[model samples]
Target: MLSLHANVYAHPEGAATGPRRELRGLPLPTLVGPGGGPPPFLQVLPVTFEQMQAALAELPRCDCEPDGFFLLTGHTPEGVFWRLNGHMQEYQPEDADGPSMHRIELNGECPVASLDAVLRTIGWPKAQLAFELVREGVTLIEADFREYASQPATEGEPRRPDRGASRVPAPCRGRDDAALGTSALEANASYTPWHITFGTYGTRLHGDRRPTVDLEHNEYGTPYLPRNELRRRRAEDTLTGPPVHLSAEQRRLIERLLPEICHRGGWRIHTAAAQSDHVHVICDVRSEVHGEKVRRLIKRWLSEALNEKWPDPNRLRWWAVQGSNKAIKDESYLQNAIAYVEKQRTASR
Candidate 1:
C-alpha cells in the first residue's frame, strides 16, 4: 500500500486544494526521501541569466508575482521531475550582467536536498532543462504569452533556444481547451510527444468507444458512443482472433524489458505497468516518429521479447489495433496517469 502522507509539493495541478501552501516562510521536514536522505542543506550552482529570466518570467505572465518563491522541481529529459529538498529564497539580480553567475539560497535556516543526486537519478546531461517552475499548482508555461524580452546573445549562444531544443515546451493552449482539460497533444505540450496506440486483436471491445482515460467525466471530458460497437465488430471480424491474455511471467518480463526498450530508443519510461490483455507505459519519447510508428515499434519489441521467452508462432496479433496515447502536458495530468496505471496494478495483485 502507498503511504498516507500529505504531499509537501504541488499535486501537479501546480496548486493546493484550498490553501495556498508556501514553503518560503515555513520550516521544512527533517528527512527527504526514503531512508536517511540528504539533510536539507544549502547547495549552490551556476545558472545563465537568460536562462533564469526565461524561467522566472513565467511568474508575471501567469499573473503570479515575483516573490522569488516556488517549487523548482528538476525534470529529467526523461520527462519526470523530483522536488528539491528545500525552498529557494530571494536573491537580488547582479547590478552588472554576465553569464552563468547566480545561485539563490534560502535563509541560513532551511537546508536543501542535493540537486546533483537528483540529476544523477534522471541522467539528463543539462541541469537547466530539468527546471520545471511550478507555483500554486500551476506551471509557468501557461503565462508564456510572448517571448522573453529580447536579450543580447551571450557567449555566442542564441538569445532563445533553437528549434527542437530540449527545453520545457510552453503551453500553447486556449482557455477554452484548458477549461476542457484537453489532452496535451491538443493543448499543453512538451517537446516529448507520446503517441499511445491500443490494438484491438487481443482485448475486449465496446460497441461504442469513448474517449476517456477512466470515467466518463475525465480531465479531457472525452465522450464515447452509447451503443455496443465491440459486439458488432466481433460478429463481422474475419481476420483477427480473440484478445490475447499475457501470463504472469509474460507480464513481468514485459514490465522489466519494456523500460529498457524505451531507454534504448531515447525515450524515458516514467510509469509502466501491464495486465493480462494490455500494457500501459507513460514515457517521454525522444523520437520524432509518428505515434503509430511508436506504437508499432513497441509492439514489435514486446512480440520479440514474448516470443523469445514463450515462442508461439501461431499467435499473430498481440495488442488491439487502436489505443489511446495521452500527451502528458501538465503535472496534474502526469500524476493522474501514474495513479491510474499503478492503482490497477495494485488492485490486480
Candidate 2:
C-alpha cells in the first residue's frame, strides 16, 4: 500500500537522482530500506510540475464538499516549504500590490470510498487515502505517506457557511481524519548540508577604485580597503598578489571567527575560506536576519581577532563597502552559492 499510486514517478537511480521517470513505460524502482533490506512500507513520488499537475487533475473531488487537495511545489533542500507555514513569508514575492499567491489546504473527513471513487474516475486505479507527509525546503513537496491516513473526526458535523468552517465525513467513512489535523501537511524530508558560504567585497571579487561613499551606494561597492590604503596594498600584492596579503595565521584567525559570528546569531556555519581579496563563507541565517547585521558582526570579530594576533598600522575592513542585502528564495540560487563558495579560488580568478 504505497502513497500516490507508488509508481507515479519512478527514477532509475531512485527518487534522489532519477532523470525523472514517467508512467508512459518505465517501471518504478522498488524502494528498499537500508542495507538492501525489504521494501519500505512507504514509497515516495517526486513529481515534476507537469506530473504534479496531471496528478492534481486525477485527484477526486470532495464528496463532503469544499473541494480540496494537498498541493506541494519546489524541492525540500531549497527552503521552499518554509513559506507554507508562514515562517518565510518575506520570501514570498509581490509585484505592484497584487494579491498574494499561495497554496490552499482544505480538510474534511470524507469517506475513503467516496475519495477512491474520485481516484478511480481520474484513473488512479489503485489510489488510496494514506497519511500525507510533506518535505521541507525552498518549496514544499509531498514525499511519502502511511497506508492508513487519519483525518480529523468532524463526524458528519456540517460546518457553518458563514463561519467558513466545514468538516464533513461522507468521503471516507470509518477512516480517521485525525492525521490531517495539522493546519497543513509538511513533507518528511531533511537535508545534510556540507558547508555554508558568504561573499566578501574586494578587488579580487569586484574590481574598480572609487570613493567610499560612492562605492557603498554602487551595486558592487568599494573594495574592503580604503582607496588610499588599497593603493598601497595593491602595490604590494602586484608582485606578491592581486590584493593585500594576510599571513596563513591571519587568514586562519579570520576564518575561525566567521563560524563564531554565525553561531552567536543562531545560524549554522558550513565552512569559510579566505582569498587574497575576498573570503567565502557558507552559512545559514534566519529570514529576518539582516545581511548588514551579519556582515557587521563578522567584520567586528575579524578585526578584533586580527588586531589581537598582530597590530598593524593599516586597519583592514573585512567586508566591501557595499550591501549584499538579498535573500535567496529559490533552490537553484542557493545551490549556486554553495558551489561558488567551495571553489572560491576559481570563482575569484
Candidate 3:
C-alpha cells in the first residue's frame, strides 16, 4: 500500500538517464503493473531522489489526534490486538493477489503508550516507529499500509488527521486536544531534516563555489562560488591569522575529537568530517537547538583542541566568520549530505 495516499511524483528524464534503473549507482524501484511478470526493466524511471523529496515535502500534516486508523507490519501478536482493546484486522499487502507484506489494520481511538506497553508486554521490539511513505501510481509503491495526509477543514469539510503514522496512536476518546501527539504523528509524514554542510574560513570566499551549499543548504550538484570575489572577501574580513588551513593531521585530529565535543554540547554526531579549510558535521539535536549555537560550540571546542595540541602562545581563530545553517526539509537531503561528507574523506585520502 502507498504510505501516503497522494499519487507518487515522478520526473520523467532528469535522474533516469543511466543505462540501468539506477541513479548515481543506486538501484531504483522496479516499475511493474498488475500483470507483474519480470517486474519491468530497471531502465524505466521509478521515483527519482528529487521526486521523493518533493513527495515528502507534500506529506499530510497531523492537525489533531491521529485516531481513526493505523497499520502494523507483521501479524500483530494476538495479545497486542487484545491489549489495544480496539479493532485489529490482519492482512497481507498483495500484487496480482500475491501477498507481499504482513500487516495489521488498527481502528478506533488508541494511545501510543498503549501500543508501546503491549509491544513490550508481548516481547516485541519497542520504539522503531517511523512513518512509512511509498511512491505509487506510475511507480508502484511498496509499504505496509495505505495512508495520506488530510487537507485542512473547510467550512463544511472534515479534517482527517494522519493516523498514528507508525505506532504513535493518540487519544480520541473524549478530547479534541490539538496537541495530542501531533508531533509524533507527523514524525515521518513530513520530516524536517536538520542535516547541513557548511564551509569553513577561506573555503568559500565568493558566491557560486563548487561543493558549497546554497542559501537553502542544498549540497547536491556542483558547488558555485565566484572566483573573482576571493580577494575582496579577504580584504573586508578581519585577519584571523591568515585563514586557518587545517593540515591533514589537524583535520584527522578534529574528526577524532569532534564527537566528544558534540556530546559535551548536548548534540549527537551522525556524520562528520574535517577538511583543509572547512568542516562538515551532521548531528542530532533538539528542534529548538540553534545552528549558530552548535557552530559556536564547535568553534570553541576546536580552537581549544588545536591550542592544546599545537601549543600556540597566541590563541588563533580556526573557523570562518560565516557559514550555512538551514533547516533540511528533504529526507534524501540528509542521505545526500552524508554521502557528500563521506566522499570528501575518501578523496582527501
Query: lDDT by residue for model 2 over 286-323, one digit each (tens)?
Result: 44443444544455456556656674323333344433
TM-score of 3: 0.39
Off by over 4 Å in 2: 1-243, 314-320, 345-349
TM-score of 1: 0.39
Task: Judging by lDDT against the true structure, name the best candidate.
Answer: 3
lDDT of 3 by residue, 149-199 (tens): 222212322233232222112321212223212322333332233454445
Q: Report the error of model 2 at residue 47, Å.
A: 61
Report each candidate's C-alpha RMSD, comma-separated, in the order given: 21.6, 23.0, 23.0
Q: Which ranges of candidate 1 are over 4 A from the true structure?
A: 1-190, 193-200, 206-222, 229-236, 287-290, 346-349
Runs off by more than 4 Å, candidate 3: 1-193, 197-203, 206-237, 346-348
Candidate 2 similarity to native, TM-score: 0.32
Candidate 2 lDDT score relative to the true structure: 0.35
Among all windows of 10 consecutive residues in model 1, the one with the lowest summed lDDT is: 1-10
lDDT against the true structure, per candidate, is: 0.39, 0.35, 0.41
Query: Could you give the candidate ranking by lDDT, starting with the highest?
Result: 3, 1, 2
